[model samples]
Target chain A: MAQNKVLLKDIANSLGVSTTLVSIVLNGKAKQYRIGEEIAQKVIDAAMTMNYSPNLIARNLRGGKTQLIGLIVTDISNPFYSAIARIVENRANELGYTVVFSSSDEELKNTKKLIEILLSKGVDGLIIVPCDGSEEIIRELHENNTPTVLIDRNFPNSDISFSCLNNYRATELATQHLIEEGFENIALIGYKTRMNHILDRIKGYEDSMKKAGFEKYIHVKKVNILNPQAEVHSALDTLIKKKNADAVIFLTNMLTVAGLYSLNEMNIKIPNDIAVVGFNRNDLFNLFYSPITFIKQPLEIIATQAVNTLIEKIKNSELEIKSMVFSEPQLIIGASSKKV
Target chain B: MAQNKVLLKDIANSLGVSTTLVSIVLNGKAKQYRIGEEIAQKVIDAAMTMNYSPNLIARNLRGGKTQLIGLIVTDISNPFYSAIARIVENRANELGYTVVFSSSDEELKNTKKLIEILLSKGVDGLIIVPCDGSEEIIRELHENNTPTVLIDRNFPNSDISFSCLNNYRATELATQHLIEEGFENIALIGYKTRMNHILDRIKGYEDSMKKAGFEKYIHVKKVNILNPQAEVHSALDTLIKKKNADAVIFLTNMLTVAGLYSLNEMNIKIPNDIAVVGFNRNDLFNLFYSPITFIKQPLEIIATQAVNTLIEKIKNSELEIKSMVFSEPQLIIGASSKKV
Candidate 1:
């Protein structure tokens, strides 16, 4: 058996199997023949033992692929993004593709640099959480024949491939949950405007409030996460002093973490003093002593869909629609919004 | 200037400037040289106009490096580890290196694969948070003249460099703080056993308590983090059922998040009812609305030191080391350990 360099013919010689049997056995591509489990196991073990090395790189070259996927997430340190990255990596590994992770860190230049770097590394496809001012870059990638899928955020008028959640709907659901929980004057707290995800969430909250006919009580505040609780305290204090919000919906994890610190510092009790909920789930959110409610992104599902969709496009270049949308996340009801 | 294969000499000839000036301007490495900002700006502008290409891979190889540092962490979803990754990446970038990230997720095989992959990719050095059983692979790295720094966990009986908090002292200090706060019977809740970190912390806590002459009433519990709160709750309830302790000290952020949840589930209050403290900071810890004291690692300084240390060893292959250890982290007091 030719074990040193795995060739389809070697498998046929071993076990007196046909070359087609070897190919089918190796690729696991044929189940119609109903090859017994023991035979399949033998073929696999012999191949492994014989040290048959498949020419993966050559095959990829033949297929015009590197069998590598690139993932671009904003803020790799953020738990939400990291969790998504893990799922994608695990799935890609099982599918025999290596995943290279890149972070944009909420900046356009970094995003562009990351794309160029990934391209230079010869990635077959891309899964990105696109940064602002990167619409042109996405368009260029598609024009250049790269398979791409944008995850967790949306960018319009670019005609690029993506898979994202309904940010506006998710935000509206969180707001509606707050309203149902008896929080009339709701305040929205988040990062300074720029990210489409952040903006879309805010828009959703605004539209939800308008639909509920509570427009006059809507209040918005900005908090700089770098300075710790300073801005959160000021924002919460202003909301309380101005009687603008009886409850608040945090649009991002940074806001949630900061807002909680600010409220804690003020000796304010959640649900008892004011209600709170957020867009993304912090693994620790449920573990927080007070347990804040959150919208659980279909993280594992989104990751799976993003990878699958990108791989499909990688195989068939003529796939339609440079983009697709995934289902919205579910709003988890934790103690924070269970009103006092 | 040729963009696809641009050289410094080519750009310098075009700009009618010295090669040193062209290199400094293009690489953005002359900020401290006071290289006349206007001239530096002009050099860059000229390079842009001519579309000079910088061969990143070639330059990296020529400089005795690939300009990439490999960072292997256990879990990126954990804030403590993730924060360190961000700081290390930023610090390495500042030091003229980019970081390629890998997650071992506490798996030995993955750790080995990650290191080999990074080495194959020709990374100059590595900063790793090693899993429990990674000595042989690390030793292979050492033999091959690859420079490395072990972070967050210690490797025993090795000539490798490392950086970690003085965990024992920190825990002992925390235990003493609990005792000082008027809780004589203090319990220690930590992650599952067999970790160098967990062992070190337990020793410190036990030694400190014994030193205080209160060995009889000390309670120690280890819980699996996947279902942390349930086991912690059961353990706490059992401790109380057996009349074992009054206060608990969580030994890590993972445990802290879980233990806090368990305590709240049991309607326990911090300090007033049961004093508490933990190792490492969590975004949720401060946001818990109760001041949870933490041992904050100098992540930025550590990352910088780790990267620089590794790069130095890589550059100077003749460098020798039995071991290198950094200073202990500082323990901060918060409301959780307030005087009871």
Candidate 2:
């Protein structure tokens, strides 16, 4: 059965023509190759009858374009990244491209390896949510004209184009909302990282606390990507027991999950025991025992813009790279963040 | 800078050696090709000094393997599928392979296109949760010796190896649990489909209802993949008003979301107004105002088994394709499924 599958050679042999002529006609290059209309039609008809589908790998090898986009996210399980990926896939499919997704697990080495593999697979463009220590490789990709766009996070020193949420504004709004709810001694829990998104979120929390003239209670946990559950549990223990935080803001969706699980384990009441604000919106947030307040990033806008920007870069290598595009985040009030 | 990127030819030119010899040495083929030890060392040193990274495209053209596994799921945004994908990726990485993921969106044409693209890119194997109308294509793939494994769902008529939950057992156990909770007039809500998994779930629900001497109240809703929210909303209205169901069982994670949303909209108190049982376990289920009962499929076991089976097939095409492996599903009791 494998041997019976049709190839360009089969079409050529059956038609008494060269494989190159058959390939040219089958690929719709007959006019450019100066093949006669009658001959081209004959080849096309024969190919159709033979069920000849072009091998994409060979075609990509010859044309140097795979029409495959590589998307590297910190974690695909996280709702924020998953939402972006879905939108990106939809937009990319509309533009006649397929997406190849990989999770870097927030490890610089994994991100680098994934990038190399994507390059080796000959993806036409890349949309990445880069990790710390990825700046050198990202800059290298840019220098090599690889048509890459950073998403969700970016290196401050790099010139790579990116589409990210207004992280600072999101956290600021969330913290301000908690303040307005009359929750004093608010605490912030987040992954400790130099990545712009995390840093910006921390900055937002700090600014908001300073503005309210409240003592800052910040707990930055080292994110062990492989085992985040432990980190989140320990962070929550400190915030709830040691700091006696009245309100807590989670910096990422994963952190929120951990915080919620810890609260559940401790049988803590929402709003009354501790007001909560999370950075990303997810169905879990809406369905929680006490639905938690959250900042919803403009996922659709970010995805569409990142995809379009990457496509533009792919089409014209000489096109000037655009600066980062920051979309606003909306703060949604839920029962968990309400004043008792 | 792009033009300045080093190639084998550049290294060969600088080292005064043949390009073929340089390639052989760089690829660790020096011993096999019987090149002199000193000359091989020289080529390797020159290549390293020039910072030459082999072009994967050129290497793949020569080797015919990408070490890439293509995974097609119904929807990556759905937590169930995303969780499976994450596990598959982790397992595949452990086996020295990378996974390229795509969502079929439960559309036959989209699944077909994705398969073709994956094929064109020369993926070593495919792990798919097939859409309804993909039997013919899957059969064709099997005939072509494309190492493939079906996961999460399957087409029973096809000979393809699959790793899926025992759908009948899952639904039967769920229904039995609800029955044990002393809920009567139980209504089962699921996507309207003739697919094996859906059919089995329906069968399980029917069998359980029959055994309990209760009239079956099944509401098979037309799944609008493009706009599921609207479909879910209307389905809940019909099930609640027309069917007058005292208890409801959702067949999929997405449907569960819709059901919960509808219940929330109608301000129906869980267990009291309408007892609920969802098919899949998610963090939302644990955190819901009244945590909903759900069936938890062994995701890790399923993913690992599927990946390993596919890899084994890739390694030895002569290996007999194993029969379907159906893992057990655990029914977790929650507040939503409590007896009145």
Candidate 3:
């Protein structure tokens, strides 16, 4: 609606270049065309000042690609998962892709539906936080050979390319922290989910306790934390009545926060009465009414790596490395799990 | 593939009807097409048992609609905002429309950018959580006659069809709650942005204090909560020094959580040295280390109303009036503001 608005055509004519050259200049990829930096910069500056935006519809139709990346996170309310979602979005946007986001709410039917929905949306690549273990869904996606990257937590034997956190290492650190805090009998209160991340956490906790010569006292429970506070209270009641665990290790952020709140409700003080630790990290952890100790995942690093890996797959097309990238985990010790 | 997998063609063939008849039956709109209920239920039961799903792409193209809604919220990390987003999403989905979501992170520029992106994505309708009074931007959309419904908050003089919680009345209820609990000196702390929600909150606080004859004791300050925590700490320090207010009514959830955490760090006890009431309820509010009273928006009602409103606009093509539907808000009593 504004006069002097620079069209892609104007840039091409002014620079004695093709519209494709102008597109490359505006996209910051003109270097691939051996275009001189000065000419490219001039074209870019003119386009910016003129408030020029490429007509996405025309471009998409011409290229037969939306250049959009889709991210299907299983649960958006979880901060750990959400942090990764934000990182993936930022990194993908940096590499010249717009992101479309969706969540499965942990429903198997919804997960399958979302995959199909995203596919029809015409995303160039996918970064999945797979819901449950839909082996067939992964197989279908793999068969289609869509460029994808899985992160944070993913399905086992998905056979699809993925990059995830070192779940076992994170849990080992949390378990060791609890041991050093003088808690011998620890309760692993969490869901017995088939998710690889959940199993990896348990293995890490069990291995650490065994190494400390306390294998007999190791207790694990398969319970629902759908409603964290209620389920956690029930699980804690069982753990306290049966094994009398002096501390708890939460396999997920949701469980950890819920357990802490339930403990506060029952007047069980942190560290003093029962110590606490969990696998995920969040902005609210340290800021809690009482500081919560947690093994924080490197969300940004993981997201960056996943994006880079997916882009590499897109570029190479024939790249076949099923690499699992891990960001070095950090252990945060707070008053909640501190030694007396 | 499962052998008994039912398809629309199967239902159509079994019923001696067209696939459109089966679709209309599945959509519960068969009555309009003069289809029999007995036939509809038979098709529905068979489809359910066989786990049959319609091919969405073909259906959308044929129906001349995508059956998808787009919701753009400011931030999802804050449970209060996410709660509203979730409400809109579920309501839209229940009406057979899936929601595609995006966040603006309170950036004015991103808000406009998102509008453009969603338009290009070809969502049938939109429910926007606008950051600023971009009436011109909203006007462009209105001029284009796009199906849109603004919810929770909206622009100034934009003539955008929207639904809003009665913010002024809600805040008045919160202020009255604090006063009834014997908090004489009150402070209103939140972002200084020219948000309609914030302005309404200030108006409500002013009205309640005047009605209760505590107008002279009212204190207020605009804050940037997204700033460093140190900035929040300093703002709290200033409020305490300037107002000596016994409580601060936070207009939004972000301010509420930040104030609570900041006050806790200052070693200020709730309902003793200070009391608090916040708007936009979240799970952590009542379950907080210190239970906090909050004004809860009727998210489901708002979501349902917004979807109905947008769908009405979509079906009718030309909307007659600018619908400003307002839902009544509720007050959740918590221990934070109770008399000690």
Candidate 4:
């Protein structure tokens, strides 16, 4: 095991060069030291073949960037977060950064602990999907100048940067679409949260309904964020049976899926019995008995923006570019929300 | 930013104690050093309140464990992998370890690069879902005495630990069920790979077909691992149109989803036109036009076992417990694969 541990000296000895020369070239200072391209390439090839990797701990202790980033999401098991993670990883890799991911489980305690752990690991920066009431933690990160970029949601009245969807517009479009289809009673299934993004969506639905002169028929059933399935089932039951809602808009991918499951269990037909529109798309949506219409967030754009913004912050700490880029949400028409 | 950088010295000063005392308590050696419990608690509480996170880089350079593990999967966007990742992360967290994850995209080049990066970061161990033909890499990891455990797939004739499903028995059960349902022409959709796990599934299907006296009717369509959807569509076309296959078995979660998409595009009916069975379950499966029948691998068990074994190896490097555990796979009957 000890012999298998290759070192700079081994590469230098094999390549017939001084260990100092090999070290400079491998550390990406070849040009700064006026080393010839041919010689540098030779050293690099030897190092690769000998499996010589620089000690990241030593480099990090020397106050060098670790080239490592941390990504904190609510849950990796959720398809939406997983898709975003894939995109973020791809983007970060292209920028020569490795991302370490953690799921907060939508708990503030978990979020705080994960942030502390990531910080202790000396990550260059963080991209977080903040849970409810994490404003203080984010403010602390901001005060410490720890490069951070929020994704999916953002805190209002904060100087933090973010890449998110215009959630308000997304639900507004869905509610209006359902109303235009002559559905008087349209209900929205959303999470019961104080988070601005979800609150914006709920407000959008209510405002759109009021604008359409359907405020009297406006109904909403909010479900618990973490343990949502059973609550979603009961919520759907109340909305459909008690309110006799003819159409419903689900405010998130998970909620949409849960609502679909409940609707299937109740044997309610889509468009014929109760029209539906979901917040985001999953490939699973395609397999639904009635392919769902959804408001699609530009995941690639949001992920790329988050990584780029965080890297920018890391590279230029004093640049003072606190930008919040919200891409427009797109509504994908499908059989579930067809004319009724 | 400078003022917010909390240190052990700052905590010590705030709590009227020496920096050495604060450091000893925070390093979890207060009892070992015979420090009073009351004083240790005071020091720890000050550190927490002041947000004093120890520099992991310095600790790691001092030959201390980083309390970090790396997870490498084929793709985090794949629900199957994402689910396992979530479970592994939770289990590792419970054991006082943090997990950093990356995707290889099923490419050997990416897998090697990820392994190198993770190693350089001083991860205590690795849990990898190896890409195809990565036997030499796994062998090298074993020889290096790296605490590594393979998940989802395993290499034969190697003394590496792994937690995986019984691939052979899983497909055998699925094929036998289809045959018993009186389907003569049963086709298998799998990946075109030399990987043993995939080969085992194919062999299981072929052996089951020959044993049922339907040798000539046995058909197998292999799709490219990276770019599979289009190939899956063409493969399904050939199996259904040219080969007149009455039933099909998908070898993996992805292959099944791709096949279902193709069948939907081809406007083929499930069960009546072509019975189908998938390898694993996704919540998306519940929404299928005809609910999918699938083989459900015990994901929680596999993930928990992988974490436990890797942690055990990390803690006891010289313990010499090289074990490979394969859990049983259960078939979930659904309408998609009913009696013919």
Comparing only chain B with the true structure, the TM-scores of all models are 0.83, 0.84, 0.81, 0.90
Ranking by lDDT: 4, 2, 1, 3
Expressed as tens digits, the lDDT of each residue in A26-99 for candidate 4 is 98999999999999999999988877877777777886577889999999999999999999999998998888
Tens-digit lDDT track of model 3 for B1-340: 1123356888788768788888888888988888877888888887787667664434443535656677777765556555665566566656766666677777878878877776555567788877765556767777777788888886656677888888888988999998998888888886767888778889999999999999798777787635535666777787787668888888887777677778878888887777888777655675565678888888878877888898888778754657887788898888888877
Among these predicted structures, which one has the highest lDDT?
4
CA displacement after TM-score superposition, residue A73 of candidate 4 (Å): 0.9
Per-model DockQ against the true two-chain complex: 0.21, 0.50, 0.20, 0.64
Candidate 4: regions farther than 4 A off = A1-53, B1-53
- Residues A1-340 of candidate 2 have per-residue lDDT tens digits of 1435478998999999999999888778999989999989999999888888766677777865788899999888776787888899889988978788889988889998898878777889899999887888888889888999999887776689999999999989998988888887788877666788888988888888888888455544455555677877777778888888888888888888888988888888887899889867778887777888998888899999999999988888787777689999999889999888
**Top-DockQ structure, candidate number:** 4
User: What are the per-candidate TM-scores when only chain A is compared?
Assistant: 0.81, 0.87, 0.85, 0.90
Ranking 1 against 3 by TM-score, winner: 3
B99 in model 4: Cα distance from truth in Å? 1.0
lDDT of 3: 0.74
DockQ score of the complex predicted as candidate 4: 0.64
User: Model 3 - which docking category?
Assistant: incorrect
Each model's fraction of native contacts = 0.26, 0.60, 0.13, 0.81
Candidate 3 ranges beyond 4 A from true positions: A1-52, A156-158, A282-284, A287-289, B1-68, B96-98
The best-first sequence of candidates by TM-score reads 4, 2, 3, 1
Which CAPRI quality tier does the interface of model 1 achieve? incorrect
Pairs clashing in candidate 4? none
C-alpha lDDT (0 to 100) for residue B177 of candidate 3: 91
Q: Please count the clashing residue pairs in each candidate, in the order shown.
A: 3, 1, 0, 0
